[model samples]
Target: MWTTGAEQVEQAVAECVELLGAVTGRDWEGVRAGRLEWSCRRTAVHIAEDLIAYAGQLAGREQESYAPFELVLEEGAGNADALRVIGTTGALLAAAVRTTPREVRAFHPYPFRSANREGFAAMGVAEVLLHTHDVAEGLGLAYEPAPGLCDFVLTRIFPHVRPGESPWRTLLWATGRGELPGRPPVAGWRWSNNLVLGTERLTLQGVTPAAAADLAAVGDGGFAWIEGGPVEGTRVGAGLVHQQYEDGVHLPEWGMYVLVRREDGRAIGAMGFHGVPDAQGRVEVGYDLVEGARGRGHATEALVALSRWALDRPQVRTVVANVERGNTPSQNVLARAGFARVAEDPGHLAYELREPGEG
Candidate 1:
């Protein structure tokens, strides 16, 4: 995967500054920004606001809410000044992303309540790209960001969106800002940061389509893994995820999660659903651990946590798993995680964990 971080943030801001700098002397306050109600000047200021806010979120480690502060320019600040502020704030955000530890996550109110450093960086890039387009359109100037920048935003935060002929157009369409061929115009939209669930000793980080593609291609999927990790099973599972994403049927929260140890931050395994729940409210799950990490209760702990999370959902009544008849260790993990055998075929045994108090 093309890693998104401080570097991407800096690149995006540089592009924004260079583009807007050329028109700084124009009457930005009087003209509306493309389809937006804000003027080009206000849109530029908004970009700076987002950049600094993301920086504060990481630097302050503010959890539960945004940091109790806002960005305000001195009265009479001009377009050139706003561009300078954008550059400064973008650098601040980049510094935060660079210094933040991989495990750190702070508050962000989106489809989820939190985002890590990469998430914030991706969001910052997105703000610069989209709003820059708006301002450019209003100014009657042509603009197109680098395809990789657009792809970076799409793969990391817009994982559910199907790749279109152009990553830029696909991003615009996904955000309800533009049209695309053969697809309904987006009515409303929100970008998703991958979900992360915590257990006593593990954090089950949801795998984005970007990570899925990398893992399927034998990359580390951006994770630091224990030896023998990302085993064949994990890669196979990742391939299925990428396939679902390509098919445009992937629901992120119901997808794969890498089980990273909370104590040391090393990924030891993967666990997740086959897909969304069926008509009977049943969802199938599977998991695997690196050879060096097995027999330490990691799989059982993750299975128990994941199964409970699934069962608690209103649409889920049972969490199911299948184990080959000869894989007694796998069967034992399921048993310890509260799954009861429900059926058996010649090759495998099926187990189910029902919601609490369900007969």
Candidate 2:
């Protein structure tokens, strides 16, 4: 799988600068960016601001809220000066992304409250690409980033949005900048960062489509796995995730999550719902741990945390699981996680953990 990193950030910034550089003589302050209230000049500054702000979040390790700072250009700064600032700030963000550890996540208020390095990198690329387009439209200049750059942003951050005929156009449509054939006009939109849930000893990190594709292809999915991980079952689950994403029905919160040890930050297993809740508010879950990491309560701990999270949602009345009748260890994990066996077949026993007082 292709990964987003400092290089992508640098590439996006380069594309933005190259496109806007040719139009510096134009009246940027007087012209409004495409469909936005801000002028082209203001939009350019916003791109630089977002780049540095994201860098600060990761470098400073600020949690719970944004850092108390902003990027301000000097008075009488020209378009050339703004471009220089953009270049400098883009480099800073790239450096931060390059240095940040894979497991480290910082505050970002999207659908989720935090984002990892890849998430931040994708966001940086997105700001540059989208704002450049706005400025290009305002200046009457043609602009389009590389399709791979757009794909990087989409697979990582826009997992819920369906892939359209063109990734760039789909990105435009998703951001409410343009329209697509089958999809309605987007009146309001926000890019999603994958969900991360914390347990006492584990952090259940939602797997993005990018990561899922990698995992399904026998890759690490950008995770630092313990020995003998992520096992065959995890790979199979990842394949299902990518398939759902391809079909455009995958919901980030309902997708797979890697169970990472809080103590060491190494992935030991995977766990998540088979799909969204049914009409009766029931959802099926499955999980497996790496051979080297099993039998030490990691699976049970993750299951309890994940099941509780699912049960807490108003739409979920019951969390279900099916284990082969011969798999005593797997059965015990579900039981310890509060799942009561609800049914049996010739090949499997079904378990369900219900919301409190639910029959």
Candidate 3:
């Protein structure tokens, strides 16, 4: 069955191909002109070649085919052939999806099975959509995505959906879009992709208060946004690492927390908050995880637990939060956890929530 959601991949691909037709072959000059230090030849050929390679990979075909084609491009594959090859190949991949059951198995980049045409179609669509933008941008034509494609692509890829992180923000994390908050580089600990905790494939082992101090120390010279205050990397002497403190003068009430998550516990990544409570008797909450830990609702689950704990206190009545305005991903997180938007600031906007109380 073809749900509108299911056809997202196709829509992205078709738009890419159509946009390619609007530009002339010579438009590649613009591509070359604006090329990154890494890439060249922005045209149908460039887009097409990558599409074919992606299609073949998803189809469970040998990577050798894609490899040689990529090499040919690097060796200066002619624009004409590149265009023809990519266009034909991309079309064929789409056609296969139209005529086949998405669940048919095939070799994917990851070890898992394509197991269906849908998976292949999804991969193919991603390839075409991405390359199409590359070529379009190279040719100096404006590139706007189909209304919902970016959202569609992001939700498919990112695993962690947290309160401060939006689908766009998550997309940035997944695609390596933005710079990460810098931390002092730990000498003995192994570094994962973006998160700074000890890496044992999803566990937070060996993160002592001292190690947290070291991490904040690493950030001192490198991480500009995060100032190293008294608590920047203070070791609380227990298993806990108080990486950051929630304060106005020491550190702004916004944009920081006490990093939490047991190195070996089921939870992958989380943070704890400790600023003053708001009128509603609640405090702010925020956290994010490594890309691998998303989609399991760990964020919501963790926040709920934290809220319950906060509400248990007699002094607190409401929690206050300030998500980056327009960040839907984090907004969704706050919404899912029952926090509602109450006010706005010039830079960071605010949210409010009354703790669970007995009437």
RMSD per candidate (Å) reads 1.1, 0.9, 18.3
For model 1, residues 215-267, the per-residue Cα lDDT tens digits are 99999988889988889999999999999988888999899999999999999
- Which of the numbered candidates is closest to the native, going by highest lDDT? 2
lDDT by residue for model 2 over 1-359, one digit each (tens)? 45647899999999999989887888899999998899999999999999999999999998999999999999999998899999999999999998998889999999779999999999999999999999999888889889988989999999999888789999999999998997899999899999999989999999999999999999999998999998999999999999999899999899999999989899999999998999999999999999889889999999998999999999999999999999999999999998999899999999999999998
Off by over 4 Å in 1: none
Comparison by TM-score, 1 against 3, better one: 1
RMSD of 1: 1.1
Top-TM-score structure, candidate number: 2
What is the clash count for each candidate, in the order shown? 0, 0, 29
Query: Once model 2 is optimally superposed onto the true structure by TM-score, how far is the C-alpha of residue 152 displaced, in angstroms?
Result: 0.4
Q: Which 10-residue window in model 1 sums to the lowest lDDT?
A: 1-10
What is the C-alpha local distance difference test score of each model?
0.93, 0.93, 0.45
TM-score for model 2? 0.98
1 or 2: which has the higher lDDT?
Answer: 2
Model 3 per-residue lDDT tens digits across residues 1-359 = 12323366556656665665555456354344232332335445545655565555545544323334452444555555555566577676666555653223344434222223444554555555555555655567776666455554432222122212243333333343332244222223211111122222321222212223334454221111222222322222211223231111111222223233343323244345544465656576656544555575656655665666567677777766677887767677778888878888876778777855532
The TM-score, computed over Cα atoms with residue i paired to residue i, of candidate 1 is 0.98
